[model samples]
Target: MNTVDEAPRTRRGGRGSRRELRSAIDTTMLPALKRKLPLVEPMDAAQIEQIDRASMDILEDVGVIFRDPQAIADWKSVGADVRDDDRVHLDRGLVRELIKSIPESFTYHARNPANNLPFGNDYSIFVPMTGAPYLRDLEDRRRGPTLDDLASFHKLSHMLPAIHSSAHHIVEPMDHVVAHRHLRITYSSMKHSDKTFMGMTTSPKNAEDVMDMCAILFGDEFMETHAVVTGNCNGNSPLVWDETMLGALRAFCRRNQPILCSPFVLGGANTPASTAASVAQLNAEALSALAYTQVVRKGCPAIYGHYLSTVSMRSGAPMAGTPEISLMNFMIGQMARYYGVPWRTSNTLGGAKTFDAQAGYESASTMMAVLMAGANYVWHSAGWNEAGMHCSMAKFVVDAEQCAMGYRMAEGVKWGDFNEALAAVRDIGPGGHYLGHPHTQANFQEAFFMPELFDNNSIEQWIADGSQEITERALKHVNRLLASYEEPKLDDAVDEALCDYIARREREIPAVDALNNEH
Candidate 1:
């Protein structure tokens, strides 16, 4: 709640004596990523406006379906043409006016004040992938994830230098009951990590429970003004905003917490086959959701969001890391900037079932597009595989390491000690190597991002080191991380209060087996 306590990214070490490089595998993840790369804007003003105008048309003429009666009423109250309790046509004037209340940027408060994240304008927060029904375990077994697996991810997310938020429901904890899984999920996130996290939006009650838990963890008075948590609301494609998502949106917006107004688009299936057409619809949907957030509580933070993946025409399956997706990301980024709101995008995603070369290439492509497109909140930044069907344990660690690598690139070129470096070059002869030079010694540790999972050693050295592949090495790092994990600071009374709250909620909610009807 206290802005004064905002933590800056810990400065890189100077002398080699007390130096510590940020490594995802080393479990020293406190300082968060602050992106510095220039945004990639491929579309010009005219092109961007074309999409914008198309989106406005979609909003004004085509209209978006709002399944929630409260949402429909809210729209009608705001001068929208409400044809019925289920559909509303929003005017561009009203949409823009309502959108004006959204701030350009805001702070996402973390339990550990030191880990607080700058949410909107300038920074990008990398988060782990969510909603993985199955997980490829450490022993290479593909199975549904359990509560312990969920806790393992939180621990890894806490320790991974590049991961910013614990990200609620990293994987569906199938071991826990449907009606009550949220309590365990939320508790695990708070217990395993002190970072900022997303709240469960499975049901309105679950959303309220996340807020209540947050109130217990962070004080009730503190939560009144500070945005400590976030929730994601996905719009059904073809311009439909169902009650399942609207309820969660209202719950988070009422508390003044941020929500991702994302449209879940499966191109050519739920949405138009044309990339530009789909984007226009996606944009209109996002704008309507953002506008409604203002209607719920004016000035509440809302992110311009979308989950982009083109459906394969031949196979009818979703594809990731495609050029079309990247192009759409660039266009979407430009659109969000024009609207003066933050945006989110997917990252480190692949269709590969195993953590192989295909996964690496696909993830790399996605990461490049995400950073260049200037996404402020990058979800599914790690461990996403098979187009979100499963989260691999090896891939999770490897993906976190890859995020660390991307973090370095997104930081862009540094020129802090440029003159000294050139002087060092002048001091050494052209033929002479600089490896032993004082300049190299002074800056080598922080000079480059050295990934622990990657093998940069020679063939003989690699063979001598047991010739382990990346997946094998990643699994080893995962085990090492869990073994070395330490619980972050949480007050004793607060912990007890959270425990008491969860125990009581378990008794209050009815027991259910499957995670059906996330309403």
Candidate 2:
């Protein structure tokens, strides 16, 4: 074979060029990772077909509950069987036909043009964890999170390179009332970070309010055309979609913005104990909601989403990093690909109360499965612990660095300066090493992936360095990130508009003392 050498993407250009490249890539928002490695297909064609058939049979026969009058009306309009006024039997053909209009790929627009996320076709977006009710402070004490804590998480997500989105509701603003919390969280996400952010889905009005603020920031016409924000609606698992979630779905769909139709699955508690059976049921629930998005607005963007966890047989506790979890990840990825829609999966999850070895192993396992399964939107990719009960500030930074390392691995190996490397090997004899070679000097900076948090020095050096453990080290990094954070630029008029809207809404929606049920 006669062929010339191929230059790697990061061409060797000596010191000045390498420094320039470093400057460009070190601080800026990392784009959606374009994976070069092949996806891990854990199932054969026949196995996938088995899942597909089971899902279709569930939808056509068992039916999914659409617990809203409008959702039932929409289903009837789409020729679905609505007998019980809530549960609708969807035809598999109809779902397949409606979802065909979904765009296979779409750009997730951000306030800064450079941060727009590219979705689908082996592109993965790493997002921070959301919906954590408690916060594990830098002192390793658990407490209810406040608005300031929420803003801090947004700033960290912005400073981190691998995190793609400034995910809203990183933790619940327990200081704020439930009725008005969404406004503050959404505003903090927009102001603290210029990256794409998720929208509030607590209620229909809350979702509309987020869109209104986005209209101010991105312009009404621009907001109409581009997906500047995203909203996530989780189906109450075991084939149920509540009115609150459906309301948010319609609100987002009407604006032509992308919405994630996810089913929150806890195996054996909310679903069957079997992994394949739960995957089939979750797939059917997700497909019904995905099809509903098209019914709300044809051609609107949608994602097949789910939260997968297995329950313990002893106490019914949800387990993380189980073999069944990875299996579901693979099967769901396969189904999403077959249906031509983007998909989402959880990452960096653990059931440990502390960031110990259990947390590390669990998070590592989930992260590996997420990347290998080709999840398009990786939620809970960082800061998740205690089975999502709390967001740890220490684990947050470590997880971000972990995401950066994972991203590098997902990029596949680079062959920069192969011929030069071969020449260096030849110059260094069998008895000699290449540490002092010219190629080594030129490429050492870009050669290996250097992790920032983990300590790798010798015991003597480690002792001299103050004998710091991982949690303490991670705490230091968290403070450093917060101090280094720079708030992104926003138009003054737009900021004023967002504040005005929040003020008006707060006045309209009163803060109640306590709640027994929905008012």
Leading candidate by lDDT: 2
lDDT of 1: 0.86
RMSD of 2: 7.8
Off by over 4 Å in 2: 1-25, 514-519
lDDT of 2: 0.88
Q: What TM-score does structure 1 among the candidates reach?
A: 0.93
Model 2 clash pairs? none
lDDT of 2 at 105: 90
lDDT of 2 by residue, 162-277 (tens): 99988999999887778888899999999999999999999988998888888888877886678888899999989999999999999999988889999999999898989889
Name the regions of candidate 1 deviating beyond 4 angstroms.
1-26, 514-519
**In candidate 2, where is summed lDDT lowest over 10 consecutive residues?**
1-10
Q: What digit string (tens of lDDT, one per residue) describes model 1 on residues 358-449?
A: 88898999999999998999999889998898999899888888888888888889999999899997889779999999999999989988
